[model samples]
Target: MKKYFNRFPHAVRGITYATGNDFGFRTQVYLGLVVAFIVFAIYSPLSLFEFLFILLGWFLILITELQNSALEIALDQLHPELHDSIGRSKDMAAGAVLLAGLFLTIVLIALLLSRLI
Candidate 1:
């Protein structure tokens, strides 16, 4: 299990490939946003639960993006040519991430509103 866990760096390397090759600048921008929000949530008036939500949501986004990258790589390896099935699979993974993000947004809004009211 330790060996298996150690392999995660390689898996993350796959994600790094996407950031470095495809959208290095955009990836940096998102990273910056995540860091900024984390800092603000921790040091500002944000509740501990709010910080937890942000961190959990951030993790979900990262993992889903990594999974999508892995799927794309495996699909390319199996078939270099474009295919609808592969596209659908990737889209489905992205959709799941979007759904989670929507929930996270709602949680943040609700938590903040409850505090205010």
Candidate 2:
């Protein structure tokens, strides 16, 4: 039990650090706020499945952004000098976040259309 509890502070610290320092994390949070407002104003009383789907999409975007941030930070620390492979690695991480955001956008659009139409 003590062993399991020991990890909580580290987890909290990581979240605090990311929220404070990662621009992508902050952007996602702002976007999430906008989404929440839209949902409240335009699509109240969402169906359970619809709500769950939207939550999943948001989770994917947040998690991917966190991963991309971590990767970039790690790569930068490991190799401050500009290298072709390092650049490619960073680009791939960014691409992953972009894809996740695109997917979330598609899901949000579908949900909005379902509600509006």
Say which candidate scores most in lDDT: 2
lDDT of 1 by residue, 1-117 (tens): 999999999867766676676452346338748765765865587678777886786667666666666676788899888789988887897787677667667766776677669
Query: How many pairs collide in each candidate, listed in order?
Result: 0, 0
Clash pairs for candidate 1: none
Q: List candidate 1 segments past 4 Å from native.
A: 1-8, 22-43
Best by TM-score: 2
User: Taking the tens digit of each residue's C-alpha lDDT, what string does model 2 give over 1-117?
Assistant: 999899999978877898999988989978987986888678888889878887888888888888889999999999999999999999998898888888878888998888679
lDDT of 2: 0.86
Root-mean-square deviation per candidate:
3.6, 1.4
Query: What's the lDDT for candidate 1?
Result: 0.69
Clashes of 1: 0
